[model samples]
Target: MKDVYLFSGFLGSGKTSMLTNVIKQLKERNLKPAVIMNELGKLPFDSQTVEEDIPLKEMLEGCICCSGSEKTEAQIQTLLLNEDFDVLIIETTGAAHPVEALDAVYSPLFADQLNIKGIVTVADSKLWLERESLTPQVRSLFLEQIRHAHLLLANKMDLLSESEQAKVIFEMQGINSHAFILQTTNGQVSYKLLENLQATSRISKDDIHSAKIGKHLHLSSLLIEFNKSYTQQQIEDWIKTLPSTVYRIKGYIPVEGVKNPMLFQYAYGLVQWLPEYIKMPAKVVLIGENVDEVKVIDE
Candidate 1:
């Protein structure tokens, strides 16, 4: 089983940078690592910032939950079989729910290929408190994700004053005493944390809040699938993913003539594309529940 680490954070919370730094540390040990980047430019602006490229694959503009769809486990199985890396790093979008991704991977299909090393949640210390309530319930979602993490990386502390950093740390740890909270700048968290850390103590079933349907936990995902064709440019211009009721949006986009499928991922207004391969069928899958999915799909 490979060590699978999930990096989740709120919009602009520096999740990408934190993930990149961790991958760098892994590479330094001469450990072959595989990275499954959710969206091209959603967080931390892609992997170009980090020099590790031997086994990098971008989901291109959409998240794993949205991009993988019916083929979710298949994609993961593919990653495990094809990539020679010892560790798999996944960077989720700011709007993504850690529970949803966890739910996806907990499936029996990936039973042999993967093991949950732990979850690392990155938070932008400077904006966390302020954005906690300003944007679409992101603060709540962000906190929930952190609550589930084995390691909580409080990133962008350099943007905060020393005292402010302390306060943020205090508030974060207060949520989950079990979480290994670390104050960091530019996502420079150490790999030792992962190596040295043991797995989380299994909580009594009641200890962890029961994930409810209407609650943050996703009982089901509503998909808006478009059978028609679309160009990469068209999908980029039309799609928007965020932290509102619409948690995240992404899917396979086929630019008619392009050989490879063009993926589209959007979160909190940070839109990114492959800007290279353009594929077809353009089957776009949008994941959202209740009224939000309707708003995007019915339109």
Candidate 2:
């Protein structure tokens, strides 16, 4: 039976980071893995961050839970038919609701082909503490993501004090007593976290919290396509001056004097740039709420 794993979390909650580590561990055990990354933009950055040459499918400009349901089914079919993989990992966008995403996985079409392993949710400690500051719609979506998880991964533990981390775990348990809670730093966790996944059982919408009626989330993306290269100092200066509303900024940027394009990721005021060679065009995707596209372009 092919195992299907779902990684659900909020934006910048470290789901992608955790998935990378998990994929590496799975490979060491001789398991082939395929990935499906859902995004709200035309160009994707998280999928490009994955390591180890696994087959990847991008479901862009929509969440799989709602608008991308058909696309999700079709992609699963294509992967199952065209690829030889032992496990499949679906990383939903931060705004995704686990209830609806699981509904797509439990569809009758994939009942025989795919087995529901577990829904792992990654929560940012700092974000959780400041959730009240977020808009009601986004807050509800974030809560629902955590409420329906089978494994709640409390990521970014290093950023918090021991007592703070403990309190976060306590609060998560209050929200989801059934889910197994684990603390992680930089998305590193033991491979045992994926073990003993309850295969047959499925969670329904009613099983989740009493979320808002409709799946409404105010998310905007500033997609920028560029061909020219820039200096390292220029890029770093721009990142420092990013707007407070910007939730994520990722792109493939060519350096002025470097041979390869640099992969850029900035979120939660933390910045990362790694040099990598990709055949795809250089582009930047900025996701945030009520962000000014013109201002983003200026940066």
Candidate 3:
């Protein structure tokens, strides 16, 4: 039976980084790996991180747990039929609920061919500490992700002090006593550990069937395309004007003086700018609560 791992995390909690590390480790062990990446935006920005050689399927514009379930099953069936791989890793959209995602994967069409593993959630240590600052709906979603993880990663430990780290661990342990929690930086963890790990418990087929599948959160995404180059400072100024409801902003932006569009990412009020050697679409996807009403490009 093929092994499967589901990656769950909040936006910018470092799921993609962990995925990259896992893929590298899998290759090192001579295990073939395949990925199904789900994104809230129409553009598959995160899928670019997966190497061209790896078999990848992209599910965009919706969460796999709800509206995307049928597509999720179809993608899995396609991969299973056409690809030769030992393990499949599904990276759910940040807004996805753990239970619903598992339910979608438990489809009978391909259930017999797979050995289902547990959810591997990546939690932002700092975000957990400051979760109260988020909206009620978002806070609940974040905690649900942590509460359901079997192999939980308390990521971004470098940003926390000794005392803060202790608190983060204490809180995570309180929420999920069964998970094997790891304190990591840049989502780093040992693949050997993952190979031997199993989910604390499986959500039975009955539970999956009984569970509701619909809009799980108030979060939404708005895609913004840039027709003209803007300075980094201009972009930062616009970000400052955004309300606290805005959680994540990511995509390629055309910098005034740069030869190639730079990758811009904003999460939990922190901004990062990385230079991209190759030119990509000059657009940004904003994900947050009621983000569609947000104004853009005028700043």
> Which is the leading candidate under TM-score?
3
Measured against the true structure, the TM-scores of the candidates, in listed sequence, are 0.61, 0.66, 0.67
The Cα error of candidate 2 at residue 8, in Å, is 0.5
The window of 10 residues in a row where model 3 has the poorest summed lDDT is 200-209
lDDT of each model, Cα atoms only?
Answer: 0.60, 0.72, 0.80
The residue-by-residue lDDT of candidate 1 on 1-299, one tens digit each, is 77777788876777777767777788789887777666635554666654665576666556555445434455577877777878877777676777567444433334434556666888778776686456567667867877767688888877888788888889888876777888887778878888754331111121212222222212123333344445655555455422354444454544567566656555555665654353433433333333222333211
Q: What would the per-residue lDDT of candidate 3 be over residues 1-299, giving only the tens digit for each residue?
A: 88889999988999999999999999999999999999999999999999999999998887897568788989999999999999999999989988678656755345546766668999999999999999999999998898877689999999999999999999999988878899999999899778765431112221112222222223334445566788999889989988897766767888999998898878679999999998877766565544545656444
Q: Which stretches in model 1 have alpha-carbon errors above 4 Å?
A: 40-45, 50-53, 66-71, 197-299
Rank order by TM-score, top first?
3, 2, 1
Clashes of each: 7, 0, 0
Against the hidden true structure, what lDDT does model 3 obtain? 0.80
